[model samples]
Target: MSDLKRLLKSSGIYFLGTALNKLLAFFMLPFYTKYLSPSDYGEYDLSLVYVNFFIGIFFIDIYVAIMKFLLDDSYKSIKNYKEKIIFAGFVVFVICLVFYVFGFYIFLTIFDVKFAILLIFLGVITYIHTIYGYICRAYNFSYVFVFSGLFSALIGAILTLIFLIYFKFGYVSLIYSSIISTIFAILIIDFNVKIFSKFRLGFGDFSFVKPMFFYSLPLVSLAFSYWFAEFYGKFCISKSISLAQNGYYAIALKFSALLLLFVQCFKMAWQEVNFSKILDKNMMSDYYTKAINEYIKFLFLGSSFLIIAIKIIFPYLIDIKYYEAFIYIPFCILIYVFIGIYEFLTNIINKINYNKYLPKICIIYLVINVFFITFFIDKIGIWAVIFGFILEYIVACLMIMFLIKKEFIIKIKFINILYFLLFLTTSYICYNLNFKFIFLNLVFLLVFVAFNYRNIFKKVNLFNR
Candidate 1:
């Protein structure tokens, strides 16, 4: 089978899974707003900053190493690293537990009593949930993978509903809901997939530790930098404006996250297929060019479609108080578009023996992000953060260009860049017109396809064979 065919097959399954999962979470927004005040959500969002930050640090991103070590036939000769992976997860949990014990006050300031407990629960569960997902994908348990995601989301949404509506628990409802739902998810996956059966607690020569550490440790800094770059906007917002305004920003951010659902589904399947035969460098290089070109084309067109759809429909779904959130959606979507591009560029970076450039790239992103938030946010409001994110992504792409200059150039159709520019101009116009472009958006969509008719046909032709 062709690489495109395999990607299609895997993506189709994952698309269904992610769509159902994210759709459920999206619908929960109405239920949440009906019960909780903006202040409640602001505090909840604040607590999550610490939760996600600390978890990113100590969670260690070790699960990715499972794919790194095991997917290739080359690693089949070496003893499987399953036990070592489990041991590493235990080490991560212990580290997080210690951090909380000594520095509990750091959390006590931002987190309420219940929120503090929620953070610690999240710290431990990160490793478990991540490792489980990676294992299922590695073993080609596609149904199990999809089921596990849907189950977690469904259980969490249902629990949150009961707490907020029937129990009337307020913001703490989220805390209660997440902790209970994740527990059920862990139990269900363990029961069905038997992930724990493969794990035994022994050092076993400690071979996997050294290589995996070198591979993953650099990623921790990148992860931390990513969090700082992202959270800096919220921090600036809370300081310069008000918590309620930050809450609105968070809602916009959350809505933007739906786009990632598609990106992640594609990524999950892409990683499995991409790595398995990636040692054949020539074919991999050709595949990289073709895949990235299509990815870019899809990104612009899909984002344009979302812009129109959201303008016409999303306003009615959200409360009138949040109707201003419509303006933020376009910028929010741009952030993830750049992130999706970065993920694609990693195809080149992943092959290099040293990852020194990766951290350097992240540092550049962090500096730009901070400077923009500090200087521009107070003057221009939330637009600064949005522009900052776009600039950072541009810098990131430029850095990728420099790295690949000495090695290889991943050529993409330049017309796609033109399409992206056109979409950006149209989106800005639509936003300024207060989304009165119902007829215009339709005409633009039709014109867009007419302009790219050959490319669209070419995309379909890839799968015909």
Candidate 2:
């Protein structure tokens, strides 16, 4: 099978899984908003923020290492590699647990009381699920991963509805739901150990650890810096504004994150395929070129559609109080677009072993984010954070592009740029026009879709074949 065919098949399955998961979560949103107060949800969201940050540190980018190792032909015995990977992952998970226990106490003193204990539990669960999920990905068990994810999400949604709506669990419901989901995923992973049994602990040469550590250390720092920038908005809102405001921002972020579901699913499949194929010198350049072009095209279209939908479709689905969050949707979608580009560029960096610079770039963004958030957020409110994120991503994207230009020259199509600008302008007008219903939104959606029909068709056909 062609690389493109494999990517499309995997991506399609991944998307199906992601879409089902998101749809389940989306249905539960109304229940959460109706039952849980903004403050309650805000605390719940903040716990996740901390969970993500700690996960980044504890995992130390070993997930990337697993992907790279699996794709490399050097590891002849899959069973041995799987065992080693699990052992390494367990060691890291234990270390993270110890840190988390002490960290939770300190965090409680500093942050909201509701999150301190909950986050620690969620963190451990997240760690196990993450490690197991990586094992699944390494073995090219995309369907297993996808199905596990959907099942977890479904279980979470059901549990959350019961706890929050029926049992009156309040903020605790979110944490419990997450724990249930992670447990479900881990169970599924354990059952599928045969697929990943090639990797065994104490079997692979310990020498691999040195190179893996060297490669992953920078990624750890990069993860920290990236999360630092991302979580700053929530942190600032929590400290400067009210928890209610933070809740509002979180809601906006959640909706905006839907746009990323597709991008992430694509990345998961694409990265593995790209790495495996890069060894084939025959069509490497063409593969890179085509992938980049398709990525840019799809991202632009996706962003455009999201911007339009935020204005028209989302209001009816979400609570009236959340309507204000629509303002941040465009900027948030842009952030994900930047992220997609960054992910693509990093493939080149990884290929060339220039991973050291990744952390440096992230550190630059981290510094910029702190300064910008501290200086501007009080004056301009939430938009300041949005603007700050845009600034950080723009810098990251440009830096990655400059560093990787020689290997993969990013040819920016003018038509793509024009459409992006047009879509942004149209979205802004549509947002401000105050169309009473979905009429104006429907009109703009059609126009945007019509304008990009040819490009859309090309991508669809490219993947369909």
Candidate 3:
């Protein structure tokens, strides 16, 4: 099969899982907003940010390394490599556990008890899922992994609603639901481990273990720096401003993160599949260019929809108290789209083994975020956070482009820009005029779909022929 055909086929499976996951979460947003106060949701959101950081620091890079090593034929037979991988994962998990305990102590001593415990629990769950899920991906069982994620999310959302509405558990419902979901994911992955048992586990081979750790160490640093910079605004808000302000900012983030679900799934599938592809030089370059162009086009359309939805639908979904957050949604959506682009671009660097440059780029973002948030948050409030994110992604994107410019020429197609403008114009008119006509949004979406249909048909025709 052609690379494009394989990409489309794999993307179809991934999209089904991602779309259902996002739709379920989007449907539950109203329940969460209605049951939990903005402050409660804010604290919940803040804890999850810490959870993400901890998972990255603890297991994410190692998991990536596992997949990379598994893909390499040389390390495929290192006797105990699989056992060593599992052992390494256990070691990292232990280290993170110690850090979580100490971190919880400091957090509870200095901050609120509820927030600290909530974060620690969520962090533990995230760590487990990260490790086990990576094992699945390493064996090319992404469909199973994707299905597990969707099932977990659906079950989690249902339980959260039940806990909040029936039991009146409030914020704790979120934590409980997440814990249940992670546990379920772990169980599912563990049950599917027989598919990769052909690879033996050699506990005594320091040779195999050493290279994996060496390759992963830079990525670990990069992950830490990346998460630190990305969450800087939220971290600063939680510290400098009131929790209420943090809550409002969190709502904006929640809305913005809907776009990220698709991006995340794409990254997951793309990394595994792209690395597995055997392509000639010409084919590889052509594939990369086509991928980037399609990525930017889809990103722009998704962001345009989100921007319009925030203006029209978000307020009705959340409480009136969160109305102020609506002003930040547009900027947040743009920032996240840039983040998705940055991720897509970074695949080139990953393929080239230039992982060292990632930390440098992240450090630049950290400095920019800190400088802007410290100097401007007092005067501009939550807008400062939005601006900080915008600056961070803008700088990250440019830095990645500069670093990889020799490998691929990054181009912004004029047609994508034209579609973006049309979407923006229609969204503005409909939103401002309070057009109750559902057909207006549908018409705009259809027009955009029609514009892309030619390329879609061409790809399908290529496969059919």
Candidate 4:
């Protein structure tokens, strides 16, 4: 199969899988807004940000090590170190458990009793599912990987609704559902790969740990800084305004998940392409340049359509009190646009074997993000946070581009600028009209699609042929 075909195929499966796993929270917006208060959502969202950081920090992005060591052009490389990689992952999990025990009091002080416990459980299960799921994908069990996510999401959605509608668990319903679903995902991946069956209790080959940690430690720092920059907004919102106001910010984030649905799929599929093809220098420059240009075009086009769709449909689905959250969606979408680009550059960085600089870039991002939000939140409210992220991604993308200029000549196609213009126009019109100009918004979306359908769907069509 062609590289384009493989990319399309993998992206489709990943889309189906992640659409369920990540976008389930998105699809449940109506039920949540109806059942829970804004403050409740605020609590969950803040806790969620912390849990994500916890995974990145405590898990140490071990999946990245797995990718570096186990993923290659052939299965032989994976088979050689598979058990040891699994053992390394287990060792990391044990270390994280120790941290949890030591840090339990800190979490309790930060969150309420219910949320603190949920945070711990969710963190553990998410770490388990993440590593195991990555191992499954590393083994080329793409079908199993995709299906496991779908099944787990189905269970999560069902359990979430039951907990909310019947048991009245409120925002904690989301917590409970995620925990159960992740367990199912772990079980499914283990069933297919028999991960634990291949392992004995003692550390199998402690030799792998040194190089793995050497490769991953910088990434751990990068992850922490990246996460802090990414989520510092929630903290700003909570401090500057009420937690209920932070809930509105969280709602905007959920709407932005539309872009994330695509971003996550692209990241997973592109990682496969990157690791497989990075050693082939002849294919690196042209393939990466084309991939990025196409990526920008897709992200902007999707952002355009989503902004218009939200303008037309969002008011009805959400609670009246939370309607104001719509104002922030455009900024959130635009942030994801650059986020998509930044992630693409990250792949290039990894492909070029420049992992050391990642920490410096992310730390700079954190500093800029903090400065903007801290300086402006008092004046512009949540827009400070929004603007902080936009600036961060812009600067981060520029820095990465400069660093990788020799290896990858970054180019921006003219069509991508056009996409950005359309996205901007849609956002402006929709924000001003406030659901009043539905026909005009739809027209903008349709005309843009009509002009670029071929360019947009060219690679997508490869899957069918």
Candidate 5:
């Protein structure tokens, strides 16, 4: 298959899986808004930050090396890496367990014992599921991966509903369902890939995977910085504004994450294609440029559609209590648009063996995010964090452009940026004007398409050819 065709097939499989997994958020939003109060939602969101923090810090992003080594042509046998991957998994589990036990006692002073226990339990299971997922992808078992994800999501959704409707378990139901479903996913993945069965304490040489661990160590900092940049806003909102306001911000972010359904799938496919072609210097720069240009076009247009659709359907999708969240949805969605761009750039950086710059960039992002929220949150409420994230991404993209100038350059067209801003601005205006001005938003979408007709259709013609 051609490169583009391969990318599309891989992206399509991942897209189907992620769409179903994330559909849980949209499908359950109504039940969540109805059954859980704003305070409950706020607490649940906070709880998740804690769980994610555990994974972010201790998981150490070893999956990065797993993919790199597995896909590297220099590697003699993929099977040789399996035992080392399992060893790395064991190492991650033990470290997390140690921290969880130590932290659980400390947390009891601040949170309920049961809540703390459940959160740790969920975190450990999530880590296992995530590692297994990486292993499946590394083996190129795309069908297996998709099936596991789909089944996991379906089971989770069903269980969550049963708990919410029949038992009225509130936010706890969400946590419980996730824990159980992820466990099922882990089992399904292991059954198909049999990664765990390769584990033997003495069978794999720790020295073999030692370099991978060393490579992943600095990425732990990047992961932590990213985690803080994201969840710190919620923390600031809870303390400076109100838990209820934080709840509103959570709803907006969940809605914004809908765009990830596309971004992540593309990233998965693009990463596969990009890494596999790293040794081929001839087509690298030109392909990267074209891929990003087309990606930005897709990102901007998809984001515009999501922004308008959310505005139109906001009242029906969420409860009346969360109507205040609509104002933040557009801003949040725009943040992810830049995030998609950032991810693409980071992939390029990784492709060219320039990953050492990622942690520095993430640190810069952390500083900007913290400074913005700490100073302006009380004045502008959630808008402070939203604006901070937007500015952080813009600055990060500029930094990447400078860094990549020496060797690889992905030239992004200015017109794409202009239309992105214009589409978003028009949508915000129409949304604020309510349903009466919806036609104006439609006009902007059409105008964007009309302006980009050649760029869009040219790709279509190429794909057909």
Candidate 6:
């Protein structure tokens, strides 16, 4: 198959898998509302952010190195596969376990008893799943990659129902579901590919560990900092306002999961294309430039075309107490928009092996978000959280672009500005229940589609066949 065909096929599978995963989570929200109070859910959300950081700490992010090494054909040919993977995996596990054990004591003292245990146990299982999952994809086990997603989501959703509705598990239903689901997922992947059997008695190629650590060390640091920057808004809301308000903000962001899921599918395909076709770096760089511009154009135009009254719809599915969450949805969309752009831009840095610069970029995001959310949150309310993320993504994207300017040009398409304007107006009108403005929004969306459909279709045909 041609590159275009392979990309489209992989992206299509990935999109369906990701959408199903998000749908399962979305479907569980209403059930969670029936069982857990908003304040209880708020604590879960806060704990989730904290757990994410711990997750990063526990993994050392060696999954990144796993996939990168596997994708490089030349490297894979030279290295003894069984020896390299085993050596790398054992070293990573030992280091992370030492850190986890030491930090477990600190967590118990600082956090709630149940939360601390959940964080440590859940982080371990999740990190294991992540590493195996990346290897599955990097080896072109796309079926395994996609099926594992669907299987995990299905099992998670079922367990969530059984725990919350039947067993009355409350906030811990999520913890129960995650632990069970990840186990099932690992089993499925192991059935298809015996990732663990790659282990040998001794290290045949301990040399792989040095380079892997060098590459992944930066990612580990960036992971912690990037996570802090990403979750700072929720931390601010929880600190500056009530936990109930933080729950509202968290729910508002969940509504943007649709956009995020869509972006995630593209991320999978885009990264694979870059890694697999590493030899054709020059051509792929140009492809990335166009891909990102088209990405922004599509999202902005699609945002204008959306038709959903989240405020009205949410009350029916969730508690009426969170009706105010709808107001925050539009702003949340912008946060995800910038985040998606920054995510796509990072592919450039990864390709060029400019890993050191990644930490500096993440620091800018960390400081920008942490500073604004900490000081201004009390004064400006939830808008402070929104504004901080917008600024963080804007700064991060610009810095990434500036750093890579000497090597490649990433054009911000002219149509993107027009789409952005339409996006703002349409989202406002949709939120406010203004029919006339909604009609106008549809008209402009139609115009955008009409004008750009031909060019967009052409650009996606990477093989020119």
Can you write out model 4's per-residue Cα lDDT over 390-449, one digit (the tens) per residue?
A: 999999999999888866576767777787887888788877765557566777677867
Candidate 2 wrong stretches, greater than 4 Å: 77-79, 92-97, 110-112, 195-205, 279-286, 406-408, 434-465
Per-model lDDT: 0.71, 0.74, 0.72, 0.80, 0.78, 0.75
Q: Which candidate would rank higher by lDDT, 3 or 5? A: 5
All candidates' TM-scores? 0.89, 0.89, 0.88, 0.91, 0.91, 0.91
Question: Candidate 3: where are CA atoms >4 Å away?
Answer: 57-60, 77-97, 195-205, 239-241, 278-286, 308-316, 406-416, 419-427, 436-445, 461-465
Candidate ranking (lDDT, best to worst): 4, 5, 6, 2, 3, 1
Predicted candidate 5 versus true structure: per-residue lDDT over 26-66, tens digit per residue: 87789899998887898899888867765676667777667
Candidate 1 has which clashing residue pairs, if any?
none
RMSD of each candidate?
Answer: 3.1, 3.1, 3.2, 2.7, 2.9, 2.8
User: Which portions of model 5 miss their true places by more than 4 Å?
Assistant: 77-79, 100-114, 200-202, 279-283, 434-440, 443-465
Lowest lDDT block of 10, candidate 2: 195-204
**Alpha-carbon error at 200 in model 2, in Å?**
5.5
Residue 71 of model 5 has an lDDT of 75
